[model samples]
Target: MSRRVLITGGASGLGLALANAFLGRGDQVLIGDLAETRPDSLPDGADYISLDVRSQQDWDAALAHVRETWGALDVLVNNAGVATGGRIDVEAISDWERVLDINLLGVVRGCQTFTPLLKEQRSGHIVNTASLAGLVHGPGMSSYNAAKAGVVALSETLGFELAPWDIHVSVICPAFFRTNLHESLQGKDIAMEATAVKLITKAQMTADEVAATVLKGIDGHKRVILTDRLGRQAYWTKRLVRPAYNHFATKAGAKLARKTRDA
Candidate 1:
């Protein structure tokens, strides 16, 4: 059966790719973004709404619109997020707060607003886009890591809570993919170290590949979706040797800090 899918941040990047994937699978797609104009060309039955995920009013309005138009929503993809870079010592507190507000609280708001509707239907899926940063600590992304880690926790808790209502919840943990995330990273108050930039740029997968992984995860009712080999390996490494992992991460972080200072 075709599903009614709503994706936040669907104007571009991984969200847009997910929207297209669902549309191609015969699902009805509603894309919510801050973009002023919808893409000029979209698949049939795909719609776009201008939305700010940080706004409760926008969430309410978008849900109402989806409920009215689709009658029932089958999937909600919380894919909107921002990245931050810098040493924690130098990073502004407001930057951490802003990243958390958009990346973590935004997901909280989406779930809180939509859970009731999803419960009424008794069947739905909620997919939150976390990152590899969520599962393990990394250099130069303290704010981003903290936010995504919160998302992972929230998604896991939601999974257990919503299980009674038959609503499946999944957290997506993708390593790096080619996307406009660089622009979001650039907007951060702190500068990205050359090493960090190189690491991100070396990612081989496209946004479409991550999108496909997300769909497969949802279809299989996976609790966590590690979209690439790096993500999977990082997850297991952390799980198998947490102390060793932390020690290594601490050393790497110190090295990155020295490099940033030297630059």
Candidate 2:
């Protein structure tokens, strides 16, 4: 039987790759995003919906579409998120709110709306796209780091609460793949952005590679999915060797601070 999968921010980047992967596996795929789409870009059998993740009304409507069409949702990828970075004290409060509203609260709304539906069905997956920044903090990414960390925490809580219902909860913590995520930044921190781009461009994985990891995660019912090897190492380094991780982080942070000042 084909599963019904709904992916937010599915017009491009990791979301689009995920939609394609599910579709290739014969699942009914729905692409929800605020970005404009080209018909050629969408997989031939996939569906698209205009979704601004910030709005509850939009989420309800998407859920309704799934309920009406498939009668049940097998997966909900709360993957839509925007980036905002800068020195915490230097950034505007409103900017931080916007980032949290879309990145963190957006995931919250999806879980709130879909958990009941999936619980009633007694089977489903909820995959939230958090970031490596959530696990390990970096300089000049205060808003993004906080928002993704919230997502990580939220996913963990849901893992416990939704287990009895057979609803799998997975949070993806990816070290930057080549994506438009950097372009989505609303920060004035030029050096931070440049450094981020440099580091990400040096990465070996693509969105498709990360999407494959997500597919493996779904099949294995993994609790936490880390896409990049670096992310996996960092996660362990922080947990198992706190002092070394802190020292490394401090040094990297200082270098970034210098870059930011120069920029």
Candidate 3:
């Protein structure tokens, strides 16, 4: 059976890769993004819809489109989010608001909007693309970390809340990977942005690799999917060895502070 899937922010980056992956699996995919028109970069077999996660009107339109086109959705991927970074004191409140609106509440809106349909059908899956920063916050990313952490927390809550309806919820926490995620980054420090870019560029995994792992995780109904070895190790370290994790976090923070100072 070809499942109907909708992915937000599917115009580029990991979203695009996931769209391609689902298309390869013979799943019918509809990409919802902020793009005014369909981008040529979209996968050949997938469909596109103009969607802005921050807008209620857009979300409502998406739900209508899904109902009219697919009848019922099998999967909803709340993958729309912006990259953000800044020190606690230096970060602008507006940046935090924007990041949280898109990263955390965006998923919330999607789940809220789609849950009714899924509950009515009594089966569905929701995948949220978070980040390793959500699990293991290092430094210089207060806004980003808070937003992603909120996503992790929200996903967990939904896992239990939606279980009665047999609606599976999974949160993807991937470490730095080679994607255009850095392009949406917002911050006051150029050095921090550069460092983020370096980490993203130097990562060994590609969006396709991460997307493959995500699909496997969703198949297994994993609650929290860590897409890379580094992400897993970091998560476990923060979980089982708090002292060591704190030490590393402080050290990393100091290093980042020094770099920002020097820059």
Question: Which candidate leads the pack in lDDT?
Answer: 3
Residues 143-258 of candidate 2 have per-residue lDDT tens digits of 88999999999999999999999889999999888877776766666656666777666767899999999899878888889887899999999999999999998997888667
- Pairs in clash, predicted candidate 3: none
Q: What's the lDDT of the predicted structure labeled candidate 2?
A: 0.87
Q: For model 3, how does the per-residue alpha-carbon lDDT over 1-263 read when each residue is reduced to its tens digit?
A: 89999999999889999999999999999999988999989978888899999998999999999999988999999999998887777778898899999999999999999999999999999999899989988788888999999999999999999999999999999999999988997677666777888888888999999999999999999999999898888999999999999999999988887877756
RMSD of each: 1.8, 1.6, 1.0
Higher-ranked by TM-score: 1 or 3: 3
**What count of clashes does model 2 give?**
0
Indicate the worst ten consecutive residues by lDDT in candidate 3.
185-194
For candidate 1, report its TM-score.
0.94
lDDT tens digits, residue span 1-263, model 1: 98988899887789889988998899888988887678664555789887889999999999889878988899999999876766777678888888889999999999998999999999899999999899887877788888999999999999999999999999999998888776676433344644456666677999999989889999999989999997887789899988888888889877776767744
Relative to the unseen true structure, what is the C-alpha lDDT of residue 174 in candidate 1, on a scale of 0 to 100?
A: 95
TM-score of each: 0.94, 0.95, 0.98
Q: Rank the candidates by TM-score, best first.
A: 3, 2, 1
